[model samples]
Target: MTDTDVLVVGGGPVGLGAAVEARRAGLEVVVVEPRAGTIDKACGEGLMPGALRLLQGWDVDPPGRPIAGIRYCSGETAVSHRFVGPAGRGVRRTALHEALRRRAAELGVVTVTGRVDDVEVLTSRGTVRAAGVEARWLLACDGLHSTVRRRLGLDVDPDRPAAADARRGTDDRRRYGLRHHVGVAPWTDLVEVHWTPTAEVYVTPVADDVVGIAVLGPRGTDLDAAVAASPALARRVADAPVVSTTRGAGPLRQRSHRRAAGPVRLVGDASGYVDALTGEGLRVGWAQARAAVATLDDPEAYERAWRAATRDYRVLTAGLVRWATSPARPLVVPVARRAPRVFAGVVERLAR
Candidate 1:
């Protein structure tokens, strides 16, 4: 089989990031993804300032509208924060994926379409037989419920059955996300997060005449119902035509026992995920992508970097999710209204 220095499984944004970074590092890279063309997902569609910078650094510029800040609203009470630095972009997920894919291609990263199977990690190198080739190092960016992570046995406790853990982790409150695009001129240059008792709906302007609305809530949560619950959001989209079909994803959480095992390294949602409440997944995923490639020779260092890169996302998301589901859920808007500075600080910090 043909060999390469780095083999990336999954060709979403983070996977493309890893491939691009590896190619820039003067290493031969090959990416195996089952899908072709632009990829789309149920996401907020708002790239934070930091994430935009990372994309710019990679020389992958996707077309979209600029978002200057974030606004949190519930009924009449509202809190907002304007990022002090460069504004972020609200590009469609397909646009972002295509941009990365093009950049990787320009950088000489080979793309092969197929599922990765039979991963074998040896003392000298890790090899995966896929796409009619083999590679020395494997970067698993396959996403939450990564096949590579499972094949490498990095997803569960050795003594406990995975089936049991998955069953035990099941809860009635498991969250999910749904997104749809509507044709309407955005009223604000801010990413608006409209919160309700049971869900949070994010409105991001990805084009001058198009805005994407993504609803995040527990299982069985209805997107239309969630939008109806928010008077402001419902009013805004009442007359707008939906430009895209509704898309969905989640239980919204995935856990990995480790970041690296032998010659394999996990990045992006494949690594581990808390929740999407804070809109920090792409930013954190970008950071992990850089770290995974940079520390390929030292898995320990990659683990440390992974922890450092995700520290804020994990802590803040968990705290907010806990509060969102707690008895005080109804108090969120009031708290933000009363503690404007506190709310703004948190928003601005994560907006990067």
Candidate 2:
């Protein structure tokens, strides 16, 4: 028996973004999350330059972390690329979520802990209603397998459905990895991306006291084998002590339709999420969150814009995956190494 202008169904970063946006629009907001503890999600903790810009627009000051560039290495060759015009910051997922949660509270958005029992879209009243909450608008920032989405009868596209599917009756393997926090990093200013024939290693300095590192790929893909693939880099990590363990990653596909249901907007993974291999989910999510907020007066307009952003990312990331795992990789490497601009342009064109 609580009410607000908009009720958000998740307490993650994107959910917080929606709640904050509603408050800015002069609307009362309530967020319902099943869990009350600090949010910990399976994510690689780095913000793209675009996401950083959006945060600044929201008056959000991202925690300062030094990131000069991203380093990618293969068999015997390594190519380093910097974020061209704008710099990117790396913040741990936990820190980022906590920051957003606190910010939402300060903005006067009510966040309550409860799994949504259901969402009853009231077409006649022109408002979406949900468990313990009612609002003119209801946003589903509630991750994949969203209760809001399910109540509306929207189905996810079957990409890595087994691994990424949020259905109740599925048994898919979730990838797990080790992430250790360290005050020191090999390159303090670079978000290093190292590669093996079988796996990819990503290192982002998210805070002064911690560097976020994740080793992820196919489920059966062995980390030891991947590390051995990169002899020099593997030795560096192998010698270092392990500190933390983060779990679950796989190919999360983009759901087809932009709008989840009538008057119920979906943002972030709830709208659509691409495979994490490209490392652009949070960036894309933030961009859509802001755009969705902007078109609050017209949710359909926001849905169209959000759909385009997702299509752009999916096309770009899919192409990269193909090339990275292609037979012509030998040729692709030299070209990308010598002319990053060309590579960047193509990917940016598809993704942006």
Runs of candidate 1 with Cα error greater than 4 angstroms are: 124-132, 156-173
User: How do the residues 137-251 of candidate 2 rate in per-residue lDDT, one tens digit apiece?
Assistant: 7888887666666667675544444442346343222333434444445445676666666457777887665666676665676545656677766666665554456455444
The positional error of residue 46 in candidate 1, measured at the CA in angstroms, is 0.5
TM agreement with the true structure for every prediction: 0.93, 0.85
Evaluate residue 133 in candidate 2 and report its C-alpha lDDT on the 0 to 100 scale. 73
The top-ranked prediction according to TM-score is: 1
Q: How many clashes (backbone N, Cα, C below 3 Å) per candidate?
A: 0, 1
Q: What is the lDDT of residue 286 in candidate 2?
A: 75
Cα lDDT tens digits for candidate 1, 132-202: 66777789999877888888777753233346335755332367899999999999999998989899999
